[model samples]
Target: MRGRPAALLLAALLTTPAGAATLPSASILSGTCCPGTLWTPDSRSLLFLDGPPARASTGIYSVPAGGGAVTRRFSSVAFYSPDLRWAVRPGTGDATTLERLADGRRFTLPTRGADVVWSSSEARVAYARSDTTGNFDRRTTRVFVANVFGAPRQVATVYGGGPTAWLSEQTLLMSGKASASARDRTLFALNVQTGARTTLRSALGFRSVASSPDGKRVVYTVAFDSAARNGLWLQSTAGGAPRELNAFGSYRWRDARKLLLIPLQTDGGPHVLRQYDVGTGAWTTPGDLGDQVRQGDWNVSPDGTRLSYLSARDGNVRVLRLP
Candidate 1:
């Protein structure tokens, strides 16, 4: 029964949970939905760029945590505030736009052509600038820091890469290719206060590096080949060899003690979402929530209590809630 394909058995399992309460039914916001790229700090709202005509006309939509109409569409992509009061519009082009949700006041950021990230407190913004080219060009990517409404400050001149993550109030994590071959990527933790750069990881073919919420651990996926059968690894922020977990595919740290993993079979299909107990080295399926939904991205909340995944069922993208 467990060996059945996803498309055949997914709907039947939607109402059945092996051990927990039945998962929530999903609602479709539009005729089409893309895999979301950003999840809010509280893990309650999801922001994704929907495309059909292909241009800046792509809009962003937000759905409730318990599920409802996905309101609030914007001409540009949206990044929610830490308090969910406003959304910082890191523009897709030369201009930067910030939108206030309460009164709908829009502000333009002074910096031109940069990648932006918000501070932990949401009172400051950090950014990096890169050459706007569509070629095999070599250019220096520099990091900068600024208040949410003030002038920009140059923090560091990172040669090849852009900003990655903020380690502390003054430290940041950045990465770039080690050589022109584009085969090797390295991770570094840069201290803004002391101008010290620390190498974190230098795996040969690593990608999707994520810092934990507590900022003490990092989880990333390393692919052995282009086929994408990668191993999920967790390492400490203090630096050490990463410990590889048993299951493979996409993974997220639900908390420090547990991890959520989607184990993919050889045919490139996810079979189940499994929770890994770090202390006992035990892997348990949360519940038999039925078949895996195709074309859906799964996310576990920051508190590690709920799992939200978007799947294509009956030709529409429906968001599902798991136990």
Candidate 2:
């Protein structure tokens, strides 16, 4: 009987999917120094905000992906451009400062403590100012865009949600309702120059609305909307029917076409890494972390070859090589 039980266990292990093998992962930063770490533009290092007791002063710090000594990269932290060319710093008042990292030259925008979303070139930005009082989903929001050192120009207005992501230098993706009392919200695109608008999807509300790296496609979640409308969906920026993704949980774009997901299976077990290829319309289990990700604090690398997450097991940032 004992021999039979051992043989059955071995068979079960052998029957497991090879692609879902446990990925190799290691802690890159420990001692509880990270919870909001972001990857560098080049994906070579991770950036985080830290201050006194842990260091000399408050600033942004960096650590190599392969693990190394921590170093300060910026004296102050703000919404930095992806190209690392400019820093958008919001003040206590209406004026937000925009500074070029290469030179000390700066300009100010009346953003009222809201951060501006930068274009890929880091030349132009879009931000919103909303009415202070009303229902959370009914507040009037006015959207504006401006060049690095130019006057602000109002472009669009939204009721509930506002500008979510910039699809291109001239285009942006956003969500809101047409009327204050409408239950359905819309995810749409706006042309900054021509003032053209294209509606993509409608639901009770949307969450985790993420644009692809190339800004060609978007993936978002619509939950508690309806049985048919609830789940993850993907759509083209040029406008098309929304394609529902079968799986759910936390996801990040591995590249322009590939999306990596960690299912919301909190069974005190390992977290599996599954991938969906938009071009091929296929789903494959890449691998699984031997532990759970802490607070969804995980992201795919810029090159789409690796992933990093704050470990729920040890409270540290860990790097994993994808299969």
Write candidate 2's Cα lDDT for 52-166 as tens digits: 8888999999999888999999997787888778888888779999999898799999999886888888888999999889887999889999988999999988898789888
Total clashes for model 1:
0
lDDT of 1 at 184: 53
lDDT of 2: 0.86
For each candidate, what TM-score against the reference? 0.71, 0.93
Per-residue CA lDDT of model 1 for 167-202, tens digit only, reads: 667777777654445555577777777878777776
Q: Pairing residues by index, what is the TM-score of model 2?
A: 0.93
Per-prediction tally of clashes? 0, 0
Q: In model 1, how large is the Cα lDDT of residue 48?
A: 62
Every candidate's lDDT: 0.62, 0.86
